[model samples]
Target: MSGGRSAQAAIAIILAGGRGSRLGGRDKAAITLGGERLVDRAVSAARDGGALAVIVAGPAAAVPPGCIGVREEPAYGGPLAALAAALERPEAATATETLLLSCDLVDPAAVVGRLSGARWPAGADALVLRDPDGREQWLAGRYRLAPLREGVTALGAVSGLPIRQALSGLRIAWLDTAADDVADIDTPEDLDRARARSELGAD
Candidate 1:
């Protein structure tokens, strides 16, 4: 979907500033898989999915050209705070929908494609991916901008707030998908596995 009309109405917010405690505090965004940085992969996925604007909520230095970079107050404030910070940007205010993604995905393009192609259910505030094991991948979803903003507003001072708590009242639609589509790199072993999968040309 190369900037399709429907996708042009949506903006993407990538959460890339997490402190990778499991990986000895390394910068997850900078980590490479398939010879490309994770953050770069995320940017490519967002663009490929036809997002009108791509915003990376992380260190300004990690931000790639053609994408806006924002950081949550005090840094590492948590995903909800990152979302709040991104929503404050002008691009987000004008978007009809929001595509949220994290930088650690092993195959972000797969999830992005699914989200970009799926029909938004009437009356649903968000559409999230449900793994084969039935776990919701909150960040791998599409959200209606109005309800998402309202949810953020309802939770004043989102710093350090749990994402589920901030978005508790919204109506959610789930899309079931295979486990590999939702894989993320959190530890060294995970990174190794991603590299191995990449070598095998698995998506």
Candidate 2:
């Protein structure tokens, strides 16, 4: 179970429900890097990595084919709420685990493959893909459904809660990966850099 494949039947949950305020309110998922939208790239990577299901927690109108559409409460609720909404789906509860991904990943395949094939300790609640600088990309993780749901439920008022708050106290295993592989397009400058990287075929 290595090299882009996983023994667990994971469900990929792409958090595309953000307001994209940093990019002047533009839809990050719809923005094109190179020739493909970020959401499309994420969906492709999840499917390519052997995810049995792909759930996009954002605008249904923008979601690409081969993915299901779901939005969080309050229209622009944060990732926490968006994640809660995704968990309501039957697949999430039934799947062995869930792969949580932000829609703005620059190299979803590399990140997902690495995380999926990494060692998951017996008691570890989640496996986070950390950047070279050691910053945990909370969204780039694989979490056990039971632990994730327990975490989310333990913290009341999940709507509008920060992701860190939602996932606090869970035993996590971090896989330090190349920063470039986990780069996320959050601002206009980030978008430009991603485009430049894309043009150079640097993943």
Candidate 3:
């Protein structure tokens, strides 16, 4: 609550809302890598990134034990839908800022760590990570809560507003990192690449 930013009360929503449709209906959240389920890695990433609480937005029954799994409002909609559902939750209903995360990410902890230590300008509304290219990885970004309604409005007008477009006109921190900044386990090839990269980094 330091002048509208969370000192230690930040809220984050892990958008584990998808069913991994592209992965042939596998539960991407539960997929394991390096001896732990994918969701666990994502959770750890958020916690490590400084989220006090993380709402696993997906099927309640599928969430692993010890994780607070809440049902996504519209069930497997778009990223905007997932964000809207998170805002409805009591925690985000009054939150000043919420960092949104995607489950299929391979290095949740890495991304979170970089983002957790990020600095923003005065009155910043969102902190985003972008690659050297201009593609906005909205799924892997932090956003302020006050403009959440704007995100909702954008989603309604479009099938799915790009995460960056939703935060237009707000003070934003556009972070630039390597291509791995927003990498996720979306497909078999993506998974293989991530694993290979992990192996390379370890060596």
Pick the lDDT winner. 1
For each candidate, the alpha-carbon lDDT, in order, equals 0.89, 0.85, 0.71
How would you encode candidate 3's per-residue C-alpha lDDT over 92-159 as one tens digit per residue? 76666767788888888767766777766676777777877876667777777777667566556433
Residue pairs in collision within model 2: none
List the lowest-lDDT window of 10 residues for candidate 1: 1-10
| RMSD in Å for model 3 | 2.9
Off by over 4 Å in 1: 1-5
Q: Across residues 65-101, which tens digit of lDDT does each residue of candidate 1 receive?
A: 9999999997999999999999999999888888899
- Model 3 TM-score, all chains together: 0.85
In terms of lDDT, model 3 sits at 0.71
Q: Predictions ranked by TM-score, top down?
A: 1, 2, 3
Candidate closer to the true structure by lDDT (higher is better), 1 or 3: 1
- Give the Å shift of residue 48 in candidate 3: 1.9
lDDT of 2 at 199: 88
Worst 10 residues of 3 by lDDT: 155-164
TM-score of each: 0.95, 0.93, 0.85
